[model samples]
Target: MALNARLEIRQGQGLVVTPQLQQAIKLLQLSNVELEAFVEAELERNPLLQRDDPEPAETAEAPEAPAASSDELEFSDTSTAKADEAMDAEGDDRFADDPCAGGPPLTDWSRAGSGKATDLDDDAYDRALRRELTLSEHLTLQASQAGFTAAEAGIAQVLIDGLDEGGYLRLDFDETAERLGCSPELIETVLLKCQGFEPCGVFARSVGECLAIQLKDRNRLDPAMQALIDNLELLARRDLSALKRVCGVDDEDLRDMIAELKALTPRPGAAFGGEPAQTVIPDVHVRADPLGGWRVELNSDTLPRLLVDRRYHAQVQAGSRSDADKVFVADCLSQAAWLVKSLDQRAKTILKVASEIVRQQDAFLAFGVEFLRPLNLKTVADAIGMHESTVSRVTSNKYISTPRGVFELKFFFTAAIASADGGAAHSAEAVRHRIKQMVEGEGRDGDVLSDDRIVELLKEAGIDIARRTVAKYREALRIPSSVERKRMLKAG
Candidate 1:
């Protein structure tokens, strides 16, 4: 039989991702710093959006709203508009009533004494507070002040350029001399002069040379000290007897020399010219409430308070003469409204997910990592009446600060490992922590615990992990094997 195509009516439902929905999804996964940058860009593009200032006085004095159920917390157009209106009014006041407002006028250093002295003082202070000079810049400054001849200065500059971050000269003097059209002896002389610069070890060709230079600067470069410095491998192995024979020193003198060597810097130039460390800012904070329960709240410092200026939108809409301009204004109003609603929804979702995580991991929080229970995304998602994907999005790149410390939200979730006695499963993280504790408590004088021994110990403790699994966890904790640890102990 031949089939004929015909139009038929059918009823179906599907989800569609609009541009605004995509933006809201993106906001859910962004870190605190990234969210701030995104909101700043949106504020620049949409003139109707503005940032709300943080006011502690008003927040403290205002009556708290009644607690709402989770169902009532879902995103709604009416509630979102009311919230935006309240935020807009709160931000419009340039000078709100303050108990500490009736004070004397503060001093304005910008207007002090014709401003010339103030400018000079400010410049000098700023320069002092700025970053210190880099390694290359320090060397160059010292070379300029050393009173070198023109040709000798050129040679010194070449040697400085050839130096590595450890302040070691990695190039051969003969090769440098050939490249610069000079003799090796002249190059060596210039190198010696450059080595006299600050930091005590700028142009050393090896580790021994670096330490020797520092010892010479301190007038402690005796024959015994030089011999001790030459055999660093024996020192690393902690062979005090070999060092005594090589340096011809007794136990007391060897101990003193070892202490002196330990005080020296290995990489002199490492203290300069690297990116500054970044500080982690948490999105949520957990603290104990006076009512005898944990209080989980979004960090106001990290949370962005944004509002749509409805008054501005109304004025622009009233002034529009053409249909296209009116449509443009209406589109802007719609976009601004959607953005505010999305932000509010995002905050509520994050708070809900984080609160549930804190509730499930309460044992871990109250005790320690050893007490952390097994948890997964579905467990949290089902408890909160949301999809697993939504829970994943909420945890990604977000951080929470608790009494313990700041940790990523994803740190609370761990894979489950079956128990030996058919009881509740154990958390992988807890098992790893237990393994680490056991290894740390092992006796140094006795035999080290092998992977097989560890597996047996874990089984005795009601954990059913394999020997290979024990080894994997040990490696993850950066602990060496039994043989390696035994070797290290013997050497020490």
Candidate 2:
């Protein structure tokens, strides 16, 4: 082999993902809330960017509506002239020398990716003021009044911080003592005192310890109760005879102890302040059209309306005295324009993907879950002339509100189960739903359907599913085994 350096002029196709293009591709996967936050951050960072909330007078004066979209289900006010102008951002000689003027890598919904932008992650929204004191806060207050020395109070704080989300202290005594440079005996003494704090089970190392602390606080942790706690595994398995022998109690006494155990709190931390629950907003709305098919529309409220303030850009550009200042203004304008264009493209892509989904699952939307045909990303991507990756990104974190119900976009793409008759394949989601219906409908006839029986029933309905697959689906649905159900029914 000869080692040589040669410049061979080989020209071929290649994908070059620029900084701006990368952000646009990322936008496709972001949920509505995330997209809103991303746009808001961009607006704040780029001085040339502004919200697209048109003034009332401007709206009235510009009543000569932009062309309506061919699909009734497209994004509302999508083709506003102002938005288009913002995207252009003085497309003149200034951008001729620009490095990032070329557009994005994904399929163009419009003339997007025509400029460059960067990405940012920021706090999108403010959570409402919640409950006053958190778990740590409450514990700190309790520790201050517990009459502990300063060193012991410090240890208590460390113990409080060490608690898991379920209020269990997962730290080992040896580890805590080593880290704090304290004696294991002192650590144990402090732990015993902290365990006596309010919300009795906060510093326990295990479920049994948590229950024991609660029982001890209630003055019910007798020797028999301690024995019962020691053998909680037998209680969980419902081996009442073994538990009675271990606790040395009669059946009635055992039942009473078990009932008392059930009354204690397992997770003391969960009752304290935590992150507020965030509400999911659907990105697409699907409803029946008056004349015929489904009409799909974007959730306009969640969509961020962005615009590039070219006038502000021009003002800043004119005021620039140095080369650095001019370059900064130009870059800001480019970034702002790219963000607006990316958002517009994002909305269009979401609408297109969502519309195709509605069309494919028409039967499902019209009827119910049983009618949902087996669908895949490739099917929708091929139908819409997009890549499978693009479809996947569009579906990620995206949701649709249909007349039937609100569902995530990815919910429509279920694995296919082979059909018994060699006809159309069955959707795994549909099969799971059928199983649930079958389970709920049973016991009315004084019978419980076992996994094997469910598989047979499904096969009779033209679905060729295995027994183990049926069992897996049953377990996923949290449905207990047939034997357990039979015992439960008898007890009922």
Candidate 3:
């Protein structure tokens, strides 16, 4: 009884994330580009998979006849213009059929996974149109026509290469000199030469220098402006009266000068750089139907259609006599099939979820930001008869293009706060947005919108928030206190 072990059978429920489930989760989180790449890889690997309605193959014609003359080549009667005109006509038809001609289109995710026929205005249209000019391209253009000598131009190229994204020359004179194997004085000269290039404010050593350089180029570098830039710390510290007195400028003139100074970019390098915008390929499209409800559809352009090659897989299976080979082939086939299934499920689930969101948030679209009700994963999950976790998974990294704008599925879910009048739950994000608007519209000379005053205003607007809550929200929004806000107003 003490040593012998008893064998017993028991049943218990356990959740297992099969390969299919894992693939669905993974597909949910991938950005549009990554998803496209994944689909392409599947297409290459899967023999049964083919692009739906592949474009007709273009045939290259053999030379119709040998050249008639040594100096002249005979032109075909079918000219490039005719071909271009035909292409243009086809393009016109394509555009005529485009559903998203007027505004950003809302697309469905069905096209993303099913590899089925989809509307032309699919996910590919959401990409940003602007292409950033790289530093090399920027510098090369300027350097080529900079009017500098060969040696000077070379030095300028070196300096241009050393510039950071903000277009600022980040290296010290001596360090740059050492790298160039030249004296510090020579480095300084090259810097001067480089500064004369296009983008007037570039090659500046500091914020003050950058602004000063720009002002000089504009021929607006007066003594007062010069002094202010030289002593930016003093300007930031509300020493404007001192600045006015020292610069011998009156209040209005000083104000005008300060405004002008503010217009100049402190970080000139920023002119040539920006944080790349997060590109979205919407998983679903929701549009206002003529029948007076939202029409939900999928963005098909971004999706890669795929299917397993039954023949190749069968051949491998047929030839493989060994257990190891059979096991490998079987595993691969199972994985491929699972991947396709997961992708289809992912698209369908996304479409289902997005349709629900549009239904719930339709009021938000009809009105504006003010009508946006507080929504959460639990609410959506309950409505759709799914677990909160499933809703969360569906929303993760998924974007929905709506009439309001493109928003992540998760963006609809925000913590709610009670409205002052005990009406409906207000979104915290909306409250913050309201608070920002109030602060922005506050008068400079009159009563400053204090946290208490903001609370009172919000109450009148049916947002019934407390003074402490207002203060908390204000602080969270990085807004200064009543006293600080008053002082800033006075200074302004």
Residue 31, model 2: lDDT of 79
TM-scores for all candidates?
0.50, 0.53, 0.50
TM match of model 3 to true structure: 0.50
Candidates' C-alpha lDDT: 0.68, 0.70, 0.61
Q: Sorted on lDDT, highest at the top, how do the candidates line up?
A: 2, 1, 3
Q: Which regions in candidate 2 have their CA more than 4 angstroms from the true location? A: 1-13, 56-70, 73-117, 122-263, 266-275, 429-492
lDDT value, candidate 2, whole model? 0.70
Q: How many steric overlaps are in each model, in order?
A: 0, 3, 12
User: On a 0 to 1 TM-score scale, where does candidate 2 land against the true structure?
Assistant: 0.53
Give the residue spans of candidate 1 off by over 4 A: 1-14, 53-276, 432-460, 466-471, 474-492
Residue 232 Cα positional deviation in candidate 1, in Å, after optimal superposition: 16
The candidate that wins on lDDT is 2
TM-score of 1: 0.50
Ranking by TM-score: 2, 1, 3
Better of 1 and 3 by lDDT: 1
Using TM-score as the measure, name the better of candidate 1 and candidate 2. Answer: 2
